[model samples]
Target chain A: MAMVDVVVLVAGDGVNRAIPAMLLLLVVLLAGLLGGRLVALGVALVAAIGFAVLLPPIGSPRVEPAEDVAALVLFVAVAAIAGVLLSTIVLSDRRRLSAEQGTVEALLRVDHDRAALLRSVSHDLRTPLATIRAAATDLQGFDHDPAARTHLLDLVIDESERLDRIVGNLLSLSRIEAGALLPERQPVDLAELVAACAARLERATSKLTVEVRAAEGLPLVKVDYSQIDQVVANLLENAARHAPPGSVVVVDVERVGESVRLRVTDQGPGFDPSVRGRLFEPFASATGSGSSGIGLAICKAVVDAHGGTIAADDAPDGGARITVEVPIDG
Target chain B: MAEADVVLIDDDASLASVLAVGFESRGYDLRIAATGGEGLREIERREPDVVILDLGLPDIDGIDVCRHLRQRTTSPIIVLSADGAEDRKVRALDEGADDYLTKPFSMPELLARVRVAVRHRRALAAVAHDEVLSVGDLAVDTAAHEVALAGRPVELTPKEYALLMLLVRNVGKVLTHRAILDQVWGPDQPLDTLRTHVSHLRRKLGGGAGAPQLVTAPGVGYRLLAPGDVVS
Candidate 1:
């Protein structure tokens, strides 16, 4: 309406006002295109009144009143039609722009995840492989020295085991990422499972002692045996890796109504408070131990698949504690 | 007596060769077969005292090979596989493999398992012996379901007793944590639970002053050492 008034005032008395009135109609239509139906209707009404009152005095041949009225009606109809057409185009274009932006953002996020995964894999894999190669070479060079030979062999064995673990974690993570994990659920004895995982860790890391405590007569939890085993094993491994040597890694299990809770607490340094939120995120290693950094993430995935929750926190006793709670029902 | 004959069937040539060197150093007759068919043929040619079969064989399924071997021979079969899945281990055991070892296993651990498997097989074939196994002051009556330390009967929970019994039966032999869990607490018991029970059993039996000791092999399993038996 303001633009229409400006055009009408500028085309006063010196010239025929028909061209300026047409320009005023164009301005109203543009306002409607950008501002939707309400603004377009408001502008159309204002433009019609302004042209009715101002056009005749500025006409070249002193036009009659009837001609002026017909001209005013024609200008209003044309403005309304242009407003509807342009408004539909504008609205559809806005929707399309937002949809395109969403796709681009998703693609960029996927690309970022891929790059992080590759960087983690390359770095983690190279470390143990390098250790193994170096140890193997040392073994050959130190063959005559029995004690040195034994030490080198031990290094080789340890490095190979580490490599095995990293590879296994990568495989499990990929499976989880790809939505390929289909857990075979059954009645699982949580105490027994915890003990088994601890025992395995105990065998692998002699310096670390794993202690298990479970509530008396804890009910059986329904979960996939192997996947759950991996979850517990991964958690125990993470605790062992971070905990001080010879310190006890305690595993506690209890029944909480319909859910069973499994908590693993270590005696090592607790996680950094700032990184606690990202503790379960893949490739978010606090220790920078060249680990694949997917252990806790895998635990999270497996627990989620079983309708469970997992969390990382500082233990009351000054170490990292990871808690996993899974429902007993299907 | 002649050394026990052993056969290892695996598709991993590097691992197989390294294991061959390890076994040869230990004074056992080691034979290698790269495929399941070759493994079966080798087994048919000579009945080995123990057979080590890798589940991920090149020619045939390791479980099928284990099944076939079990059908033909009574020899103990140890299944080696890279898969750590519980079901795979259970299935391999169900197919008559006496023991299952996941890959990346240390040579000492593998050798210990072989010894246990061989000892177990020999014991099964021997004539019936006295039901009581006495190691120093610690005595276990297999027939009576009793355990005694220093002339006094020691009380034990059912799980504890079961665990103690397994160790007493396999005295001086390293029992892998998995084996202990499977035999004592059924196939699905937790590993840490086994440790807890072992701790309890140790406390009850008493570990000093001439009593038999349950020595842990650290990352392996537990072994019951008689009073005079040195743990090396």
Candidate 2:
């Protein structure tokens, strides 16, 4: 009676253990289809170990060790295949996403260029046409007035020069974009550069009081002199154009350790919140309609070429500030 | 100062012809060239005090043209480029251009540049002969490496001295940021350092705190004010 009771208890325990082991095998098989190779391999390993531990001693009467090894090899193969498939899908999706992003950026640039071309063309063509128009208008009244004729000729000359400038800017933009533009880097004194830029700004606008600060014993920096001049000039010009009249345009330059920063701060309404992300993008002007927007974009590209970083932010004085930072060699 | 003769080169015939009349009215002797080769040939013939060379040309690369012209004459060459590439301007200057005007520049601005170029060229020639610079109360003796104000020696640092020499050398003429950088700092120093140094020099030169003798030209470089030029 005692032997029969012990046998019944062992049987009940074995049945209970087999059900869970079998359920675990089912979970592993299903997981192998969707999981990556590593995950599938982990599940398979756990299931195999669990089954071995749970199997009754009666199972020792059945399969050979070589057959068991073959079954383990087959499970590993399936897990590896699942992992490879998952990796391939993930990689391809990433590639597609980047390519799409590249296409959109290119499209945006193209649109910007087209708009710039049109704006410049219209403005340039207008000047020459205005000149010719005035000339013809004067010629029609030539017999009656010499002063009118002289004035008309002057107008023609002025307008023609304006057209020339427009054409020049268009060509310049192309060269810069094509990487054909090269800067003659040299040691430049910031104090003089700022002072010069400030003087010009002072003369150009009554709307802003321009101030320049250059500390004593500042070190000279390597740069393309004319190019930097253009950068500073464009910034000041942009500030003068955009900042409200009677506001201040502060052009400041300072040395940080291992770097130098030049900042052009303006007292006017700051950047439009909508286009902040795209501010450095070509033609992404904060001023809604009138600004070329290419000015800041070109500035950013030029600074980048010099291995410098440019950023725009609201000024402490409550306007816009454009800061350019370039690394100095140790 | 009397008006100076200038040689203007561009392929645009109508525009050139109109500009000729305009320059004439402004008391300038103007010569026009339609091509790079012709402009070069013209430069050899007259050696005009100033040459306004357009970058877009039929025969030669504008940079090459600038190089060739530089080899032939010391006359100030002001490049007129349609491209705003800082690199292009730097290259032009490297190739011997003294300055540049981007496309769509204001006529008044262009004329002002021309005037400065002519004045600068004459100034350079004068320095080659006289070797001294006198502006307002400041006198720079280039040969002696000396600066004096009202007959008193003004002490300056090595960098300040170099900066002063550069400014005095090109007095009344705008030196671009790159040009000044190249002249004062060795070419290896970065631009931010250049700005920092310029700031330091300004403070040292008494261009501090509202009173400034040095002037900044927007999108360009620096210029030391000429005599009688008041700063408010």
Candidate 3:
């Protein structure tokens, strides 16, 4: 302001002082940048009054009406253009800041999950291996005790199965990601598949009751039999782990339009509604239960291969309901 | 069954050693061959009671080996396949391999599959065409076309009768869905039809104290388990 004032005062001829026009022009741009046309007009009147009082001898600059009006119009046009550009930059800066914030949040979440996954994978793998090691070592120490031998052997077998499940799921995820798991579609009886998975898991632990219900003549879905079997088995594992001991984990299958929906309902404390979206995320179940939290993620991948959809929700009667729907024809 | 001979054709020495120990404990003789050529030679030297073939060999295509082995020997071949290689397993079955088990399979599961293959081979050789084929209390008297469970007459359709006869012939062996569909209903039958028929067979021949079990191997096929068969 002082530099422009010095230049304007040195150049002004008092009567036809046109240098104040430049100062008025700067004020007009700031007015447009700050407020709408009404406010711009108000600021212009104040600036003109200030110029008249503050400069004194140069009462008004460029008193010729035609040239003065033309200068004011030119100043308003320049002010509006500068205002639009400046506002655009400011708005864009705000948007960029928010986008960066979102990226930081997502990265933090991924980092946390990666650490959680590492912790979970280590626990899942080591717990079983440690149990098997202990049981096998103990069997060597116990001399000719049949009961102890049988118990230790069972521990070895059961723990080995647990380890196998974890390793299998992890390997499957990599294979699936590599596009190595192509679906070999075939007609399958979902009930039979569930029963087999349930039977296999039941043998490993007789803790939960599995009741698989598929209508006698339910429509057979065309899916990759092996992959779909794996998907259902993952769901069953999740349900079985969550369901209380001696409670029934209900697995039922039905056809809805072109899709066959399979649901797993557990009697244990179900998931919170807010966790519905993240249920299929890897390591979402990393609660230190020695389960491969990657099961649900693998299930999602397999189901996706069949052009299917899988979701998690709170069951009506209080428990988690994990539903998988695969098209009848893939 | 006097200790049936088991041949394992796999390069993995760890599996061979473990299975050898298991077979030894069970009084079965296990002959390990590390490649396809050696496996074929072993089979030709003296056709083993059961051939446990690995579908991944260093020398030849495992499926081709399965085909050649099928051509040379009538002994049961149980193909050992990798976990995700369902296509290879099915192809081996189509190439006349008797049964298959995925790798990383449970020791007990592998043993049971091997036992089934051995029992089926021995049982088939001992009695090729019997008038009355019975497993547990369930009998299919092909002579009179009579089906009876524990002395009670259980009537079945001709298709069911034929299916039961086929399963009876290969007692403990797991017949693939393709193999069963091809042999039973000719070809080009929907697998759903086969699954429906099998489920019906299971429902009628229900489980109890002393009844035969029609077990489904999920994505694979069905096997009829009698009391003394496949008990490893």
Candidate 4:
């Protein structure tokens, strides 16, 4: 009889029965809200609650336990289905976002690679062209006077050398960008490499005296011989350009713990104060005219890729000093 | 007699024509190849004494051209590149180019390399002298310009060999910096100029930097010592 009375109340006036049923459903729906499926499964739970409350009571006397159990099962089943759907939708959205992020990153890398290639290519071409022009221009001056022939020939020689440098830079940049430039790691003698670089620098620049301060029998470190050679050469050349004519460009190599440190210092104007913040950034040269600005950037890239560190600072002697540190094992 | 001929390849027509005229005035026969393909064809058809190859080419890569020429021809290939980019020189040499010249180069330097290439070619073909000029364990032929130490030949550049010859001729005797410069480089050469050339010689003749074969007199001049006389 009690069960029958409960059934009668459940089947009473639509508003009275629906209100209590809705309140009970709200309590269950809180689970969906807590599960982060509020937007996905909340509305379905409200409909189920309304149906449970407003349906007319059955004419049969006592409530059928079987029927009550069946209705409850239906409510739980629908709620579970809603939760699953909500979870699937959330997971799919996350996957799409991740994919989009990956694409953007790939695009950025491609753009950077392309930009570096174009800059290096253009720079390489300009060098040879400049050489030819200088050589021809000097020759023209020589033609006006045969005595000037020797001087004009000298100009041609210098420019041809310049052209060689430009080509080397372009090829190096390309290799770095392609990620194909693997270092031939070996137990390198820092003293030997520095000496070679300084010797070459002196040969290239008639006015500079390169002084090397590397102790003999320095322990060897693992590094790509040629790439490090290029880095040293670039630093020496930069020093030669900025240093006063006939001044000494000092190349110092020392051991710091398990790492080797090499520093090239010149008696020239140091980096511009304004550009110090972006020192290793590509195309960050203060001199807007006739400078490639790729030198430091290349140095940074090479050192970083090798898990090394490189820095530039104004020397106490009113010049610039470039210091590079490479681990012995790396 | 005309000077050694050179083939220069570049895309800049005006610059090429100008360089050709310059070379002509110096009594060299200049062949201009504006494209990489053209340069390769020229190298194949008529091998010039020296090829001034530019890295930038319209049709093909300059490095590829350099490699191809090195594979097929023994002609001295000099690479021309821009300033602040010297890494290419090593690569070109590794790829078989004889020497490299950077842009904004003086004309005198160009002629000097030209002379060196021509001299090297002559040395390779002519085998007149077989005796090795020995200094300590190190030996080299003055005429043949071949160097060997401990029975192994030491490769040297044209200028490096010349500098070594001058030093060896005055072995154990300190040659004044001025005297050495005037003898190797022309008169009116700068004082500091000798140091640069000497540094190159020391590297090639023996181990570089603090090697025992060449001794720097610090402010006076330099002396080439035998291997036994190497200072620690």
Q: Give me candidate 4's TM-score against the actual structure.
A: 0.40
Candidate 3: misplaced stretches above 4 Å?
A1-330, B228-232
Candidate number with the higher lDDT (2 or 4): 4
Per-residue lDDT of model 1, residues A1-330, tens digit only? 533543454344334675767677787778877797667877877877776665555544333465555555666776766676677788899899999999999999999988877756765665555445545543443333565456557656766776777787888888887998777999999999989877765645566888899999998888998888888888887776667778998899999879999999999899877668887888777232325578888888889988899988888889999889999994
Question: What TM-score between 0 and 1 does chain B of candidate 3 receive?
Answer: 0.90
- As a whole number from 0 to 100, the lDDT of residue A177 in candidate 4 is 74
For residues A198-251, write the lDDT of model 2, one tens digit per residue: 665454454578888766777888777766776786788678667876887877
Per-residue C-alpha lDDT of model 4 across residues B107-203, encoded as one tens digit per residue: 6666666765665565444533546555666677876788777677888877677778776654544455666777788788887677787777666
DockQ of every candidate structure:
0.01, 0.01, 0.01, 0.09
Choose the strongest candidate by DockQ: 4
Clash count, one per candidate: 10, 50, 0, 39
**Span of 10 residues, lowest total lDDT, candidate 2 chain B:** B203-212
lDDT (C-alpha) at residue B214 in model 2: 79
Model number with the top TM-score? 2
Off by over 4 Å in 2: A1-78, A98-102, A105-330, B58-61, B81-87, B102-109, B129-131, B204-213, B228-232
DockQ value of candidate 4: 0.09
Q: What is the lDDT of residue B35 in candidate 2?
A: 76
Q: Whole-model Cα lDDT per candidate?
A: 0.73, 0.66, 0.72, 0.67
Cα lDDT tens digits, model 4, A119-180, are 65566466556656666655645654554455445545655766676567657776777887
State the iRMSD of every prediction, in order shown: 10.5, 10.1, 11.6, 7.7
What is the DockQ (computed on Cα atoms) for candidate 1?
Answer: 0.01
| Distance from true location, Cα of B161 in model 2, Å | 1.5
| Candidate 4 displacement at residue A55 in angstroms | 13
